[model samples]
Target: MARDNKAMISGFRCLCAFIFVISACSIASFLYSCQCTSPCHDPGREWGQSLTPNQTIDLLSFPEAWNNLNFPQVPPPWRMKIAVFVKKWPHRSQAGGLERHALTLHLELAKRGHEIHIFTTSPINASSFPKYPFPNLHFHLSKPTAAGYLDQSTVWDQFQAQNSSGSPRRPFDVVHTESVGLMHTRSRKLTNLAVSWHGIAYETIHSDIIQELLRSPEEPQAYSLTERAVKVVEEVKFFRSYAHHVATSDHVGDVLKRVYMIPEERVHVILNGVDEEIFRSDFKAGKNFRRNFGIPKSKTLVLGIAGRLVKDKGHPLMFEALKQMIRENAKFRETAIVLVAGDGPWGSRYRGLGSNNVLVLGPLEQAQLARFYNAIDIFINPTLRAQGLDHTLLEAMLCGKPVLATRLASITGSVIVNGNVGYTFPPTLELLKRALYRVWSDGRGVLEKKGEVARQRGLQFFSATKMAAAYERLFLCISSMSGGDTENQCQFEDSSR
Candidate 1:
């Protein structure tokens, strides 16, 4: 009996030591991820956070070496180059949604051994883009055209001088343009051309501007008028040359097809995705984040919002809902709190209101923002309207938060109305109030269940791996278009309702 007891004690000691080693390594890995300042880690993390993969696997983990972070069995590094043309880049002060997406796509391509050149107009706001973390990425300031635009020939000539001294100039493996109104060149001259439409084109703006101009008497505005007209013509001509078109959302895809008569086969949809390896909730972080925000532990209730604090994002709607909730029941005032993440034109205005319940955390990097997801019982995306799928909502979902999204065109009611994940509402205060009440009544149970469902859905349909694979296939198919005149101006009747 004495010998058996000694053996059991020794076994326990060994098990404890193994657990200690795992705990120590896990903590160290988390600290490393938290300290990472790569543009990839730019804007989100809740304080002192760490990441753990689904099975604690290091495959595609955060804080990874660039070359090691990619899909399993990814194509061997190929000698390919693609240029991403955009009007602005992040940190250039012109930082907006477009710039963020540009960085994201560039980073993804660079990981795949594709040389990426980020070309942009002379930023209106001096873009102090963070020093790129990846060794393979490059940026160039294209010589401006006569009108100071990044027209096709402007970039083509910029590359012309650098051409290899050999027979048949090596055509670019791909020319990818986004947001910028890409100037189309002739099909035979170019091998691979792609345009990523963020939303309705500058031509959409042109039609509206032209109508407004014609309404008023031409006040010697002929020079500016004629110049804009010429630019529009060039843009249309340029678009016809795009062999492959990409859109971030179905709404934008529909707009492109209707506005430019693009075909369904030619346009590809690549939804923006969150980096889950960074955004996963510290399932253990419950209550800690709430305490840091000074909320009492008794109430399992807090409202959360993230994104630009602009009117279009529906900040006022949230304000109205709060007022209604306060008036409806004095009890809710004690239980509810709202934490707004992100800063923009209206952030100051909301701060000025000085509501006791609203905590405005201006803007946070990606991983830091995950804590806000950790802190709150519910997430609200009251965008009155949106041009594309609000990726903020997707991130919230990834973090296991139940979303309260508006029934907007981009986030169709059908897509978000799954009872287990979130609730959809028309842009009305009453509807918002009702939704909040339902969420608050049994908030914890409802949110937990919905969060599980969200994780499953995201894994199955919305992962970066899935999105990248889709694009890979799309790229392969587009590169094979050797015949058929893709520029035939047949009027496109959009069937993508």
Candidate 2:
């Protein structure tokens, strides 16, 4: 009986291995097909070669001398009636990265005299529906699902009604969706629609792998490779329903064209941007913030991290690295301080390192976040997720603080362009430890200089104004194309002197 049971167990193991091999081969073949059939196969051309001059400006320098102009300051040649679809808006305490992005982008667009209409889920607190801050910005609220996501059917109904009203002789000049509006986009052909992909299933698969690899052996795995493969296939098909795609990072844009088979012309790469007005450097505010937190002026380095303190956000990497640093080096334990701003399961774990080493401040408001960024000498984002670029990293840089982040393509390719701006390490405890030690060895003055470099890069590429301007150009180009203008005429004119 024992011999028979052993044989059965061995047979089961063999069967599972066979299934995994088959699944992996299937995914590999699909990716190979993408590469063969897409522009990626062309040896003479580059990943973004097919993009027009305007679309490549963010990734490559402009041919002409460019001036850093604020989007709101530039008067639009013509006002555009725009419809935006997003899952949620910033209301009360429900501010996530996507919500903040939608708010920032639309606010800037509205300020520039664009008619902005937002279709989003109702606030959890029904009475918390605030009045519109801008006359051109209107909101069409839909009841949310139990999962707190927007009701797609309800949003579609509202959108259709607005289109049917015909108050404006023409329909919306351009429709923008922030990783939402799938129901509406899939239902019909909307020539002027642009869907911004914050993260795709292919990227999520990479994230899941990183999370699983980093997770402790005792922790139950949260992802199945087989399931992820299936989901990626489904996502590639579903994405084809949209007319245009906005990739939040260059790496993502590359993936959209090379792996997802999105046409290079249809994919636009725009890095995530932060509100420079709020997050810019302020030495006085930094000093005040440190004093309020009771951090001593003598502390050699004040390292900080903000955003959800969840495992996927790479808290485990920071927690483990810092804990080891304190345990191994008495000088580090005494001289360095880590400020953790945000709430999650890892909050208690971070606090477990003790108040002397790590200050676990709960989730902070935007104003407080600015102060937090200013207070820190160096910002550390040990995130494992390789999807969208974290706004916190950009915010920190805008506040003139350097970053030590994971070496993800999205971040390394865009945000941390060079060692002068910041440092990066592979997602491993040993590499992270080495990177942290380097930061400690370099000290404050060196890091501050790096921070200045990072701030300059942030202003040029990742500022909210820069982001809005890119979107503005894209919207106008899309509108022009829909009106039967030639693609060459849609080229964005650089108004910089």
Candidate 3:
């Protein structure tokens, strides 16, 4: 009986040891699986951080070296040499919307591992633009003529010389130029040339003419008559010089096909993008930004406008509508303030109309402008031009501020929906006043909700990442088609749009 009991105890001990071993194996497997999945899944990080010596040697042949910072998933590097031409670069002073558009899009492309060469005339405000430095990027500045214009031939000649070298070492896969870059557009060497149209210059001239008619005849002309006439002729010739065109909006695309007679197949619509990283919602930032400008916290609403403060920008119309609103309503005069962020000849003309309600804080740099957008409750774009949507609208919307723009087809045709992101009013004073009163009476919470919706839309549709990807795809598509193959011409349009 004693021997049998001892044997039973030994059997129980063996069973207990088996159970402990199984649990240990299970825990070890679980931890091994988690480590396998968690630590090395990031593609950018893997490329940047864990390259072998041979891989490092391969990557070193290219200009973009692997860095520790993990970037968003970018396209497989095409490693193509690309040349870009712009009338003005956003380096010196306050760049116009077009210049900013070019800079932002190109910089994003550079980050994605393309070799980029920028050719431009020296900025008019050289003091404001120091030398810009970027890895895998080169800038060639052409000296301006005594007449304060970049001589197109000088740039064209340099481009030709570089491209004609026939050395595989200096091969350029594509050339990109702005709409105003007439000489570059005429390049015969690269069939893969593209022109980006920010706005139709003829339409701009027409709008400026109408604004001039509204001004007093005694007021000096905005430009000498010869300069005005010369600009019109230049625009006509430039559009006729047709290359593949990129229009920043559907409205601009329509204008390209209809007014400019660009072939539908030749024109691609790629909307302008905003840097979502910079222009994002910050409730706490609002008070700080306003405080910097001496605006009181008690002010119920702030209406902000950022762009050139010129007649063609529809500042006069905006002032007329605001004055009429103030005269008709007392609450608007007391509760709301207008912050104009730009500089132009029209700044001093309508300074005293608002009785201290309007504050024109001249041209702001991009960083200050981001803060300015955050400070405002709503953005008002009263532009009366037939020109396409402005970049300011996207920037404001990205910052979670709903935009109230004039209901021109140009503004209406973009991503903005009436009463969803913001409201749009007719250019008429009565309509503007009605829109203003509606926002004023509904309270700030209503606007804040709409601003949230605007931000969501901006994230989905107008991000710089998406924009750069679209352009890259288009460039690749065009490069492929330039090789005696026209079958895939529409291959990237859907992806880009």
Tell me, by lDDT, which candidate is best.
Answer: 2
Across residues 40-83, which tens digit of lDDT does each residue of candidate 3 receive? 22222322234332232221111111122122346655566778
Predicted candidate 1 versus true structure: per-residue lDDT over 286-401, tens digit per residue: 46777777777656677789888876667767776776676678678777778888888767655654456677887877667878887787788887654556777776777777
Per-residue alpha-carbon lDDT of candidate 2 for residues 1-497, written as tens digits (9 for 90 to 100) = 99999999986776586467556745865776576654332322322334443342331222111122223358577888888988878874347777788988888889889988899888767788867668888899888888877787787778777765545565788889998654544434788898887877777767877888887889987746657766677777878788888888766777777667877778877777888999999999999999998998768889998888888889888898899999999999988999999989999999999999899999888889999999999999988888887899999999999998999878876777678888999999999999998999899989999999988878877788888887887788788778775553244433332
Order of candidate numbers by lDDT, starting with the best: 2, 3, 1
* Higher-scoring candidate on TM-score, 2 or 3: 2
List ranges where model 2 is wrong by over 4 Å: 1-73, 166-168, 184-188, 485-489, 493-497
The worst-scoring run of ten residues by lDDT in candidate 2 lies at: 59-68
Each prediction's whole-model lDDT (CA): 0.59, 0.78, 0.69
* TM-score, candidate number 3: 0.76
Q: In candidate 3, what residue range of length 10 has the lowest lDDT sum?
A: 59-68
RMSD of each: 23.2, 5.1, 25.1
Clash pairs (backbone) in predicted model 2 = none
After aligning candidate 3 to the native by TM-score, how far in Å is the CA of 256 from where it should be? 1.9
Cα shift from native, residue 344, model 2 (Å): 0.9
After superposition, the stretches of candidate 1 with alpha carbons farther than 4 Å from their true spots are 1-73, 76-79, 92-94, 121-127, 142-156, 159-170, 184-191, 201-241, 254-260, 285-287, 352-355, 413-417, 482-497
Give the clashing pairs for model 3. none
